[model samples]
Target chain A: MSLSIFLITLAFIILLQAAIPFLLKRSIAFGVTIPEQHMKERALSSYKRFYSATILITGTLALTVYLLWAKNRTLSEDQVVFAGLAIQFGVLFLSMIMYLYFHVKTTKLKRTHKWGAGLKQVRIADLASHAKDEMLPSYMFALPALITAGLLVYTASQYSQLPAMIPTHWDIAGQPDAFSRKTPFSTISLLLILLVIQGMMFGINVMTKRSGIKLTSAKKKASQIQQLAFRKYSSWFLFLTTVLITILFGFIQLVIIQGGMGNAAFMAAMPLGFLLIMLIVTAIYAFRVGQGGSRIKVTVEDEEAMETAFVDDDQYWKAGIFYVNKNDPSIFVEKRFGVGWSINFGNPIGYIFLLVSILLIVLISFFS
Target chain B: MLIQIETSSDIPIYTQLSNQLIELIARGQLKGGDVLPSVRSLASDLGVNMHTVNKSYHELESKGIIRIVPKSGAVINPSIRDGISDEHRLRIVEELKPIIAEAIVLGMTAKEIQHLASSILSDMKEE
Candidate 1:
């Protein structure tokens, strides 16, 4: 594949990864109660997304530059390759800046008396206040994503001006430019546009999380239906991104190989493999999303019951105490300590190990 | 030291820490004036928030089981004073009355329960 083509492909993949989290965040934000801990989790996930994108864009750009220098005898002196690299690096650098900014802001918010005090108070109003502050970091985080999308669209526009093929009318060199031409913009724009949409989705999520009012009895059923629809939408979003990338890459490879080498056989095998992988991943993700959504529903129900009881007893002062009632079987005894309380679902040591593994993957990809 | 926290258990973490430490002290496993791990260190090691550990330390301090200096860390109390007044003894009995009643209902004779209590005390002394 040409260096330009490879860079465009990788950019799309990174964009897909970026978009997935935004969609997931939106679904979660809209469907569940926005606890302080959930906000922290969202921030952490955004960091992961930023880290992944940095690794991907850096690795692809480096490889593309090397390939252009070594393999492309005709386009070796082309400034387009260098310009593309500069744009990619600019995006990567901006992403890092945004990541750092969000990280610092979140850490400050976490340590500050106001955020900590509100969480401790655990009132509906207090949580809403914290959620509002949480949105500030997200807005800061989205800046880099926006910048990358703009640069990508510009790069794609420039690339479109290049002739369909250098030597032939339909073929670029000996390779057909079918896939590149079929998509008017480079794949990079496809990915970035998706990312921009993802950003808007995350905004919706933040709104849902921050809204403090309970769903009225009439709205409860509708809300449940909405939650289910959102969950399905998120699942399909991830599935479609995976499928689209797989098909686009496969098509590009086929176009590069030019129509003679058993195209039908390769085409048949590729989509089957893609579908298998997509199904497996989508199943796991869907299950997790469903489980998390149900848990949120139960929590919301409990909160409603507690609110009603508190009002009846006129125990306004005790309402924010956040005590686990003695009769509540669902309250975990150890989680009351308030630390490592967010690390749930199994042994703490194992959970920490998984988190470390994810961080190591990001670091490895970043430096490689 | 290994600390296990079962979130689903009825006992709160701080109470669990207190009871476990008290049991350890009663059995002479933790010596007087021995330094306990700093709150932050222990909290991170145990994958908990520092506030949780701080609450446990405060409880221990109030019971004179440990002394927490602002920056110097926690230390086991040097003296185990036997300062239970008569009123305090009555208060202790008052707390135990419900448990004793439950035990009686569970089919233990007075002599048997007394004998069992003595044996447990002897076991503690041996440890």
Candidate 2:
């Protein structure tokens, strides 16, 4: 059952990867910014087909190997899982290689054509676009935080009831594989970690709400609607993830406090169920609202001058993926290729936040 | 209001920003007490330097079209509250002097210039 679940997860990931060419902003192809009219070029469509075929074939081969290896009775479950993970990572690495190859080809084509040259490169911004209004209310995040805090307080009150050796780690079969002496801090440590992670999600929510909305210049009103809808859906998705994670951790905490006495299959299934829900939500949101809301339909007349295209600031995007602009004060911008935001590499604050997050994770792991 | 800046235009980006904003206000799309986005947000959205947005905001403030409160950002001032001052009148003539001179040099009659101005005025007033 676990293997089947893993296979399904892997298939979903591969499907998403193969759909990238169709999922990206209409102006962007293979990480290269192109004129809107050039999107229908024969060469571009052929490249997309080749990319998808390569990814699908590679993914199928890797899954087959994983299934064959797992069915062998000699290996333990942990070893089988590790091998599956390694195969998954290998597939991901190859997909990156495929993407880079096509990225280079598209960039070359764009250069040879001089797509946006000698045009009035313009950017449109709606002065009335309110960041705070585009997001879910801040109070919605408080429920999970409140639950975590309540759990922490309850665990403290029942500290004496916990077993001397508290279960700190559970394996794939949901058996307690690791334990730590039940000090007051160790008893409530998982709750603390949960709170910290919830806080991080809240921080990201704040960042998304604060970031400026970037609109396509051709149809200002239509683009504004799309941008706002994208923000709204993404914010809701983030909130759902946070709440789901909080509930899972809360469940785990309750089982731990009860001396890790739970049904083995159910315990193992909890996380798998969470993963499935998250994947389904992500697929729905991505398809409904493509990267930068490119999939959303909003009609405006094509009355803007043909020469006036969106500002061709492609020079700042490294390989059309990494955005490094020294002048942009924004720390978070919508990703050029993906569903959500990417950090501005030129901003020192991005590095600072990243380092802090890593340190926090390490510290939490150490304490627990 | 959609504010667009043409990077290849002869006019400076800051001037274009301010002019578009003024046009929006004239069209009644932005009214008194309307707040503009902050300089950092606007600049990043437009992919321009923050200083450019700041310059444009200051230009609006100088013309008494908006008030830049330190923490709250720029807000449009009530246009009916203040009559045109002599300083503003003089500055307008100074700015348009070269344009009118070019029109005359190009052999435009006084009546034709008046006709052009009235047509533009009517266009702006249209809903």
lDDT of 2 by residue, A199-292 (tens): 7777777766766777776556676777888889988999999999998999999898877477778888898899999999999998999987
Q: Could you tell me which residue pairs clash in candidate 1?
A: A332-B7, A333-B7, A334-B7, A339-B49
What's the TM-score of each model vs. the native? 0.31, 0.94
Error of 2 at A73 (Å): 4.5
Candidate 1 lDDT by residue in tens digits, A327-360: 1111111111111011222224334544555565
Output the number of the DockQ-best candidate.
Answer: 2
lDDT of 1: 0.44
Show the lowest summed lDDT stretch of 10 residues, model 2 chain B.
Answer: B78-87
Question: How close is each model in CA RMSD to the real structure?
Answer: 20.4, 2.2
Candidate 2 TM-score restricted to chain A: 0.94
Model 2, C-alpha of A192: deviation from truth (Å): 1.9
